[model samples]
Target: MSSSNKQAGSLNEKAGISSPEITNASAISQIKNKRRQQPSAEELISGIISGNRTTLSRAITLIESTNQDHTEKANQVIKGCLSEANKSIRIGITGVPGVGKSTFIEAFGKHLTSLGKKVAVLAVDPSSSLSHGSILGDKTRMEELVKDENAFIRPSASGETLGGVARKTRESIILCEAAGFDVIIIETVGVGQSETAVHSMVDFFLLLKISGAGDELQGIKRGIMEMADAIVINKADGDNIKKANLAKIEFNRALHLFPSKKSTWQPKVTTCSAITKDGISDIWETISQYFELTHETGYFDEKRKEQNQFWMIETINEHLKSDFFNNPKILSQLDETKKAVQNNEISPFAAAQILLDKYKKI
Candidate 1:
């Protein structure tokens, strides 16, 4: 074995964990000695742009990794695929639980695919310690749709965040676009107004509602409603058709009461039944119209640019926080600083500055 391989093996054994270096070296050696070929990042990017499922999955994994060293390579892959991205219509869907959000998506996604459009569904489930790393089982709710050749489904856990969305959902959207998906649907857990995280990244915000007697409005939070580009009254078929119509009118009135969006686009309210497949097409048409009007008025590009800026700022802040907290000296001093502040020996502000200064010197 090579020196690096031996060192990697020793580290893995000492740490009682599988070392990534060892795994990577083994992969490289296998490719060279057995497969006789290795795929480059450019090849992966090209394959992703061409809609290869395998490449798309790999690209998403790369972007979602928290490993520091993988970031540069991940960024390179994203940049190479960037020009081929941003073609998809990005949509954010949220609603209270039992409102049929998953069913609606499954139906809507199938509808889009039937129209010969490639669809990517990113379902953001609230993360729990027990289930954080596992793929959400909600895809089973989208069984038939999941089986569609042109549809891609990725269920991401929110990771101790209220939004039940991964921080990388925005980056995942870019990857999906590069993978040639025509429509990218982001589904958030229907837990009150906190779900608005999806709103910032999508072109249209869709709120799914179930018609309940006057209680519909009670379940709807003002913050969430204000961010909605469209309110969908789901489960509109069977015995609830009349009630659904009433609920739609009520929501429309409530929507009108709110000031118009900054983009000058009026939010629309409609009713649909995923079970009976009613009004799904009209919902799709409304989304298309919203995109058309927004694009024509230049808001589409402007909104995307703003989102890009927001992500840049957020990423920088995250990097600074991670770097500061991970520094060995800062970490070692954290307890002492906290105790000093508690004992009134140093003010919190001064303690913070001291730590920051220490970090700067390091």
Candidate 2:
């Protein structure tokens, strides 16, 4: 057979055309080395202070880690960044599903960046009960803002743990502030206990709503209404403008029914279209007014001090719960105890006592 025929017959023969490598071997090796080499706590702190987004994200990952070994290092980094933290305005935004929370955040975030503000968005995506994984698609949703040089968006998974995302979010805010982000926006999962958790951590909590969702007055029944620093009616454009205006009026009326807030600043109701960017600046103005009033009244600092105390207590409670569940003896007997309780062989309280006693013995 001819050489050409032999080449055609050989299925394993190399291609006739030699393809050039698309990637650099040396660069790939350097990236691998960088990934393998973990920066020390001090280095992470320094990087965060110097506004390195990569280091800030790495440090936040350490905080979110469930590995016991990472806890100490995470704490050290947080401690070093403490002073740099708390300088930024922490804003928490939440809403019901389909309320365009991501779109509104993108618009709001872009508006902030336009004013030369360094913005960091911590978006918490709900984790699946079965898979225990988060889609974490906030970056995809906020396409324009994600590309903005002055904006940083980090999406985190809201784990099964009660305080999982909340605790990590609080810590991540500190890192973002240390990274020189003047504005920090925390977008909650919009349901469950997430709103309350986020409310406790933020200086300003804005609830995003849409027109014609339901009876406008119905929202007043929710505890979230009480916690809101402002309620924004999103997607108010084209034909929806009139409905949005009506919703705003209804919400404003509803706001007046609630007793005066401790901060003495009434929660404002406004409308905006994330697509058109209409009324977006007005929302910022409202927030600025809130900060101005709160600062003058000393509520800004006072609320922060109180939140710090609350977190300290929450931390102790969380550690206690973790230690109790993670106890080896309890883990060994947990299934049996749970089975006994489920079968009515033992009372829940008594079974809990048994676990407590076992933990105590250890």
Candidate 1 C-alpha lDDT tens digits along 5-53: 4443333455334456535866655655655443567887888888898
Q: Pick the candidate with the highest lDDT.
A: 2
lDDT of the candidates, in the order given: 0.85, 0.88
State which candidate has the highest TM-score. 2
**Which 10 residues in a row give candidate 2 its minimum summed lDDT?**
3-12
| Clash list (residue pairs), candidate 1 | none
- Model 2 score (lDDT): 0.88
lDDT of 2 at 153: 96
TM-score of each: 0.84, 0.91
After superposition, the stretches of candidate 2 with alpha carbons farther than 4 Å from their true spots are: 1-33, 163-166
> Per-residue lDDT tens digits of candidate 2, residues 1-362?
34453332122246463223674656655766776799999999999999998888889999999887898999999999999888999999988889999999999999999899999999998888899888999999999999999999999998885533545888999899989999999998887578888988899999999998878777534688989999999999999999999998888888899899999999999999999999999999999999999999999999999999999998899889888888787898999999999999999999989888888889
